[model samples]
Target: MINWKVRFKNRSWVMAFVAQLMIVAQMLLQGLNALGVTDFQLTDAVQQSILTFVNAVFILLSLMGIVQDPTTKGMSDSERAKTYKEPN
Candidate 1:
């Protein structure tokens, strides 16, 4: 079984997954449009808006992940430095 909590803790991974999902959705939509099943299409302004929204979401998630990282939680500067140091 997948550990959803652990998977979602890394914001970059979540962002990349969402981006791939969006690309797949766009491809499906394009296929449907070509088949004339639906006349759906996005204008340049709408596309720009979606891009901006996705970027904002990515930034917010990144900040939240940084703030919630368990390794550095409640650690003082010296302690954190030691914890993060190379083993060499």
Candidate 2:
């Protein structure tokens, strides 16, 4: 089972959740427009921009999670230092 409390505590997770909600809202709007229930509509460029932004955000957050793995918690300062080399 998922731990909702801990998950919600992470800022990246919260942002991702909001992004997902935005996608859902877009879907609902599109559906309503298709059914002629609402005259309002988003342009193709606007929809594309929203999806691209969300995809980029998810990719960034995934990379951050990879960089923050739990294994680093057990590493000594010297060990951690050895893992990242100084730029030349």
- TM-score against truth, every candidate: 0.45, 0.51
Report lDDT (CA) for all predictions. 0.60, 0.63
lDDT of 2 by residue, 18-77 (tens): 766776887898789999999986688997897788778767866776323354454333
Model 1, position 62: C-alpha lDDT score: 57
Model 1 spans > 4 angstroms off: 42-88
Backbone Cα, N, C clashes tallied per candidate: 0, 0
Scored by lDDT, model 2 comes in at 0.63
Off by over 4 Å in 2: 42-88
Please write out the lDDT profile of model 1 over residues 3-87, one tens digit for every residue: 4454455565566667657767867876898899998778979978986896676567656663333554453333434443332
Best by TM-score: 2
Error of 1 at 68 (Å): 22
The TM-score obtained by model 2 is 0.51
Q: Pairs clashing in candidate 1?
A: none
